[model samples]
Target: MSSFLIICKSIHLGNTLKIANEMAKILECKVLEPEKVEAEDIEEAEVIGLGSGIYYGRHHTSIFKLLDKYSFKGKRVFVFYTSAFRKVKFLNGCEDKLLNKLRKHGAEIIGVFQCRGESRLLGGVCKGRPDERDLARAREFAEKLKKKFS
Candidate 1:
């Protein structure tokens, strides 16, 4: 079986981590914080998922830093995130930022996953999100990716 690794930075309500955990369970892989990941861990994985909670309309700065610090050249990479808003237009723009970063690092983009997350900003929005329904979808996404790539 192809090995899978997820590098994620989940803060706040741990919303992104919940989604990451679901995906990891389906992939039967380990989830590591960006800070905890080593170069060898990245080197050993056949598939790597870069995940984080959206902040200020983009991925966490630590995630961006990981992209800057490592070489993902020719690596199979997937992107995932949790955001308060799920609008197509807004999401496309948000994903574009991370996509551009991955391209610059030479990662071979494989898939993308995203979902709504509860946020306390602006009198709280999307509360109780990334709920069971979101987790089920995340698992299904991982299963499909595993089938296609593994």
Candidate 2:
């Protein structure tokens, strides 16, 4: 069986962790916070999922640090993110930023998923998000990834 690793940075409300957990459950993989992940963890993973909540239009710094600390060359990678806005334009390039970094490491990009998340800034938008619908979508995405990479 192929091994999967999901590393996520959920600094605030945990929306990113919620989505990561859903994917992990469907993929039957392990989910770890960025701080808990090590070089060996990345080395052992066949397929890696990187996730985070959009913060100031980018993934949390911790996620970037994790990427910087390890090399993902030749690994298959997928990315998922939770953000405050539903409009893709409002995402502030979070997906692209992560994707580019992964690409720079020569990782094969397999899939990307993004969904609205409740925001604490300026009141809240998409309240109660990473809701059932979002989670279901995340799980479905995971299933497709599994099939494609299996």
Candidate 3:
């Protein structure tokens, strides 16, 4: 059986964690906060999923630091994110940064998923998001990823 790891950085609201948890359930994988994951965990994962909520137009700095701390050569990677906007363009910068880092570490990216998430910042945006529909989409993405990598 292939091992999968989902590393996520979530803020106080836990919107990103919610999405990560949904994927974890679908993939039957383990999920951990970035701070809790170690280099060995990254090295051991055959397929890695990195997820976060957008913070200042990018993934939380913690996720970037985690990636910097580990080397993921020859791993299959997937990225998922929740943000105030539904359009991929709004999250492109964050997605690109993660993609570049994974590529730099010689990882192959197999999929990407994005969805709207409630944010309290700026007086709130995307209220009630990552809802049932969004989670369903995430589950579908996970199923596809499992077929591709597992």
Candidate 4:
């Protein structure tokens, strides 16, 4: 089984990390915090998974910095993000940016997995409730990713 390195970073909540952990367990991938991993560490893994909590329509700074510092040459990279907005347009072009960055370093971009969670603010989707269905969908997404990449 080829090993993978999963890194999750968030600003307010760690839902993305939790989901990534679950997927790592099933995929037999090694999970690490973005702050604890170095650029060289990423080079050793066949796959790299990045997860983050969306804030103000963007990923955390730590996640961006990790992507900026590392070269994902010849690696399979997956992206997962948790957002409250059902339709977030600001993030529309981010996947392209990430893919371009990874490709510049000779990496293969596998695709993205996203899901909706509870909204913290006064006005948003399911403000006080996180639908069980949403998490289940996240799990399903992980399963599909495992089957495809593993």
Leading candidate by lDDT: 1
Q: Which stretches of candidate 1 lie over 4 Å from their true place?
A: 90-92
* Tens digits of per-residue lDDT for model 2, 52-116: 88887888888889878889899999988998876465547678888898899899999989999
Candidate 4 TM-score, true structure as reference: 0.81
- Superior candidate under TM-score, 1 versus 3: 1
Off by over 4 Å in 4: 88-94, 122-125, 128-130
In model 3, the runs with Cα more than 4 Å from the true position are 88-92
Task: Estimate, for each residue in 98-138, the C-alpha lDDT of model 1 and write its tens digit.
Answer: 88889988889999999999999767999998999999999
Give me the overall lDDT of model 2: 0.88
The segments of candidate 2 whose C-alpha lies over 4 angstroms from its true place after superposition are none
Could you tell me every candidate's TM-score relative to the true structure?
Answer: 0.95, 0.94, 0.93, 0.81
Worst 10 residues of 2 by lDDT: 85-94
Tens-digit per-residue lDDT, 38-96, candidate 3:
88888789999998998777788888898678887888888888988655565456688
Summed backbone clashes in each candidate are: 0, 0, 0, 0
User: Candidate 1: TM-score?
Assistant: 0.95
Query: What are the per-residue Cα lDDT tens digits for candidate 4 across 110-132?
Result: 86877765565645564532346
TM-score, structure 2 vs. true: 0.94
Task: Report the alpha-carbon TM-score of model 3 versus the true structure.
Answer: 0.93
**Cα lDDT listed for each candidate:** 0.90, 0.88, 0.86, 0.70
- The CA lDDT at 22 in model 3 is 89
